[model samples]
Target chain A: MLEVKGLMVFYENALAVNDLSLKVQAGQVVGVIGSNSAGKTTLMNTLSGLILDQRIKELRKGGERITIMGKVIHEGQDISDMPAYERVRLGIVLCRERHPVFPDSTVLENLAIAGHLRSKVEVAQTTELCFDLFPNLTRWRRRKAGFLSGGEQQMLAIGMALVVRPRLLLLDEPLLGLSPAMQEKVVEAIRSVREKTGVTIVIAEQFARPILPMLDFGYVIENGMLTLTGSGRDLMENPEVKSAYFGL
Target chain B: MAAQDTSKQVTRRRERLDRGIKVRSEDIYALNSWREALYLLAPRALPVVALVLLQLLAPEYWQRVLISTTVFALLAISWDLAASSGMVCLGQALFFGVGAYLAGIMNHYLGLPPGLTLPLATLGGGVICTVLLLPVLRLRGIYFAMFTLILPLMIERIIEATKVFGGTEGLSGLTPFSHPLWESFLTMTALWVALFGLRRIMASDYGLVLKGINDNDRAVMSAALNIYRYKAQALFLASATGAFAGAFMTHSYRFVGMPVFALDYSILPIASAAVGGLGTLAGPALGAFILVPLSEMLRGLGGLRIVIYAVLLVVFTVGLPEGVFHYLRRKYTQFERWTEVGK
Candidate 1:
């Protein structure tokens, strides 16, 4: 449902996402696996059109110049210059890296805030779906999102993104800083999300072991350039992928 | 191959690089060459020389304006210091009022000269201000700002109600500087000294601790440092500069009163700092020099003066948020050119 062609992102002089390209089909679990500083977050930001917002802010403050050169096509329409909010309206929602939730808001309130565009009935239905999908969040519905554990916060973040009822969901390092047990729970939740809602999801992560088996298709990126592309099982067995990501 | 073909298209990006001399002079080797040494000194020395020259050339009325400008400039520097050190102060008047009152009281009651009154009032005012603000030092962000905003108004009310230190009428006919030149000379000296001194302090290790406290006091605390003590020290330094300005102005006008704590004294410095740039001690001072003089020049506008003045400020803040000094500094130190990407 999403196509990135010759995507090049520059933060000042540093080339973040080199002239790289990728595609994600509808209802598919596409994974972009890379180590630290592999431009994973930059790629996610570029796809969601958040980079455009950052570019304007940085320009106004006379900070580092951000140059984006590429086309982001969603369902055959060019969304390269579209702002982040507009992209969201087009049902391209991004759950950004780090468990970023409104610290002061309760879990329910956080979900409600994310579902602002939807009808009250739609929002209520999705909120129930989110709590059901991530059962850990149900107990903390009234508790502040900030007080939630890292794993619980991650669940809340994903659930918050799901509340938007996105056609194409982009998850940036969703399992970051979570324990092995929590990672398994998140991976299970991702599996159930696709099974139930059939949402097209693009997950950018460094932890390949938990996600690789679940991904229908996987792309290995190193230093902002796409290095390998294959089925999840094929990547799991690959020697290079084994050593770099799986730490064999 | 298709990506390679697309990448071949010419795309230019503006590349900024530091000047060769700027890089060279950053090293100790710069001291060996007179050119590099002169390059470093020229920016610093020229301003000092210009201020002196302007004092001699300007008419008496303008000189008086210059003195008041210097006072505002000093207050601006203090504001910048407090802001950079993580204390967003809204009541520069608190410091100014305390110092003015102290100087006025000392001069009027004790029959002290400008020299004795100025130093005593500056230090004493700083101490008093620091003690008063000590309770709210732990309050972060808007809470602290709100407390400071109320302080001067509270003090004004107290003075009015108690009728202490001449109250509404205020203490007047205090000792002025013996010579007009001495007034300008002292103010100019204080301005440069405070500017350079604060800049030097900010560059030191102590300044790093202060800055660290501002950035993340918890992180600084994790490193086993007492953030409160550091904050207190920063508060003392900032208030001292503000108090000095107040003391100087008191002697210059030969009067001190409730008007010392006026919102003009509080706001002018912040506006100057915002226009000039914050963090850089000299930048706020430069801002004051520009803003104060500009305001005086706009006096012809009469009723429309503030309207035009405020509009220009909004324009500067919105159009050039980086402030004049930072922009000028970047331009002076670096050169930019369009360069082809991925060539």
Candidate 2:
């Protein structure tokens, strides 16, 4: 389980994630849906500790020494301000949505590249499990990641992240650019993963339409704020949610 | 009928490609344009090649031409380090001369043979270069190139003013290899071996990390790799290899001087890599062969080869900066990317 509290981030003076807090219980899938400029990516980047603020880079001439503080309790350990790799080692992984596989590498190489932080993922078992999960992958096992189709790439990315056997899986827009058939396939894969591993997942999506039924709890982040939070089914029928997304 | 014919044609094409067939497509033309990078080093080597061929035909110039080619190749290989890293270094001759002089000084003044003196001096030169790299490695773009250039220029002036290496003329006639032909062969072997080692390193994972840094610094760091260390390591390896070539040059030429460490020598390797193709294992050698011979032709015209050199460099850097090997590599990488993107 992962617990986030009073999480706030800034790009110099511009606040990106404004006083936001959220949590994912053990073995549960929590989805975050937001419109464009809703700070979904910023929140994810901040959480993963790859903060690149153009404002902070350019505007600040002198160090006012602005400090950021947040408490991230993961498996009952405080990991706020922890280095990114350390977070990776603690069974926390992020699948950067549409971009997961290193296109320069082979399909097998891309899949193997993940779980690098996990002290060990015996080459044989990892290959076996990954191949079994996506049968389409075996044919292009020697092919480069750059040669893969959208659905295949998505599968490769998800397969790569899941191989790490993380306690917390942060998937950012995993379904983006995927076809309808592949979308169902991805959902099926996520379900199977949840069934097998009980890994806590924080999947941020653009809309709540497709993923709402799968999540136990959900939040609708709007204009850099966590505007609404509720049980998944309740939020699905919420007027504001329907109006903003779901095209109701 | 069309479907059967098309499938058969496709199969035939595939078989031809497998049989080392040359496809005369636009891709090969692009590949050839990249191969034209041989102009970079031809300035250093072409004269030697021509001279050697002339000597072979005319009776006794083989030794001199062979000696000249090896020197140019060694110098070019030394400079290849900077060019391949996408960093312009102008102080390579400084390291090359330092290695040459160190080994020369010890051999001539202290009676050390090429065997003991050469490797030691090369290692010493590499150490000195690593120290220099510590400060200059922080710089990027022109500043980096300038600082690297400044080192050799400053050293050359100092050596001249201080009456070091016989004050500009330098120590001479101390054979690193006793015979001219032996020296040529040894030095040539050393250059190839050094290049072989370097090429292996350049094609490895860590080398790819350097390319990643050159491509996208933030992305590389985000992947949790050290950028500073990578830069330093690359420069260190380059310096060491340059020093090795320089040490071998001392024995072959039987001389070590400030002039040997001049801008001409410093920039030769860059030209070679540009012509041969940056990051290619054999690019510098190829470039050196092409360019060195042209230097002699320029000498006949009162050093007008520089104009040729400048023109070729501008044309290569402007029109074909990737060099032959890289251009070909990029084409394949692009073609593969296109295939993927299409799907």
Candidate 3:
């Protein structure tokens, strides 16, 4: 299970995310939605251990330092202070949207490298498991990732995250710029993998029109605050959510 | 309606913004493991094997060419290590030039034997470079490169001006080579050893991190790697190799001249690696094989010799940016794409 509690983040002097808290139970699909500058990216970056502050005089229970306050619990471990790669090593893998795959690498090479933190696994074993999850990736395994189209690159990215066998997979805008059909295909892949692997998932997405119906629970972020929280179906029908997100 | 669209846009923006900031990219995997060693070791043995064959077939008259080429090859390997590891350095001659002169001085003034002279010169160069490398930790890229070139040339010119060490005439009567064949043999052995050692280091986990620093330094640090230590270590290692090469040069011919340690000695090895390819282990060796002999064989052709070599180097740099071996690796990738990978 992954948990975030009393999360407060500031960019130098400006508070970006304030008093935010959320939990990702094992095998649950949770979503965090916000527009640009809503502190969602900041949260993800902070959680993933990228943005580090030198003035971090004190750390909250979950926040990386005093300039920040948050709780990020993963697999019964509090890795809020851990570096990003260590988070990856602990199976908290995030696959960013767009061209996440290494362009110079072959698809197989990309998948194998996705499991790079787990350097102990034999190459052949990694290939077999990765190929089993996304057979399409197997077909394109030897080709350089750069030539892969938008959708293929998305698959390769998610496949890379899966190769680590991440217990908690964070998908950030996996469907962006993708065609509607391609978006549905990627979401379907995510759902199938969730069911197949039973990995806890925290999906931070903008195009919730398609993803919300698939998620179990959702949070609505307006100006860095959680405005609404409920089952995905309730948030889908909420008049406030409809006004804020959907033109009904 | 605009507000609704805006909300969707905000959510979308949030999503794209979050990504794995971990620096362990596929290139890291490629560079870190023993596979990189295979890339270097397999190809480098080719030239060494070729040299061994040439040694059997060729006569002693070619000793000068063989020794100069081998020593230059070692220098090339060292230069490649420094250039490829991180940033750029044209100032490698700081140690190379210093070692040559120091070796000359030791061998001349102290009358050190060939056995003692060679060891002293090489070890002295290595130790001095290792020390100077300390003050040079902070420099990067062009700045780092300039730092190397400026100080060394100034020092060389100053020492040359002093004339206390034979001035413009250079130091002579310093006979360091025991036998003609010994010089060639010693050089070849050093080249092979340097090749083996560098290839090993490059293949190690350290090389992978160094590549990470080269490609994207911030990201590597975000991955929590120690960038400064890696740079310092790699630079020190490279200088040590140059020390050996310079020491060998000063002792082998029993002569020390400013012109000998000029940019050509430095450029010769770098150009060899460049023509062969940067980063790849065999690149420098192959470069040395092709250019050193060509330079020696065609020295009679006057300026055309350098012109031809320069043209070839340019063509290789432009046509094969990855170097000769890397080009072959890319071809291997392409071939696989058409064959098994396509299906």
Candidate 2 C-alpha lDDT tens digits along A99-150: 6688889987776678565445464566667677777888999898988998
Which candidate leads in TM-score? Answer: 1
lDDT of 1 by residue, A47-75 (tens): 99999999989887777889888789999
lDDT of 2 by residue, B222-309 (tens): 9998777887777667777677667777777678777667777777777777776765657677777677766655666665767876
Question: What local lDDT does model 2 show for residue A58?
Answer: 27
Q: On residues A67-90, what C-alpha lDDT tens digit does candidate 3 reach at each position?
A: 455567776777778877778777
- Per-model DockQ: 0.43, 0.02, 0.02
Best candidate, DockQ = 1
Candidate 2 CA-lDDT value:
0.69
The interface RMSD for candidate 3 is: 18.1
DockQ of 1: 0.43
- The residue-by-residue lDDT of candidate 3 on B1-343, one tens digit each, is 1111111111101111111211222354545656554554554566677887787578765656777777777778888887766757776677677678777888888887767766676777777776776677677788877777775677668768897688778888787676766676777887777888888878888888877777887888898877888777777777777777777787776778776557776667777777777786667877887788887777888979878867877887776655665555444332211111100
Local distance difference test values of all predictions, in order: 0.91, 0.69, 0.71
Q: Which ten residues in a row have the lowest lDDT in candidate 2 chain B?
A: B9-18
Instruction: List runs of model 1 lying over 4 Å from the truth.
Output: B1-7
**Residue A132 C-alpha lDDT in model 3:** 67
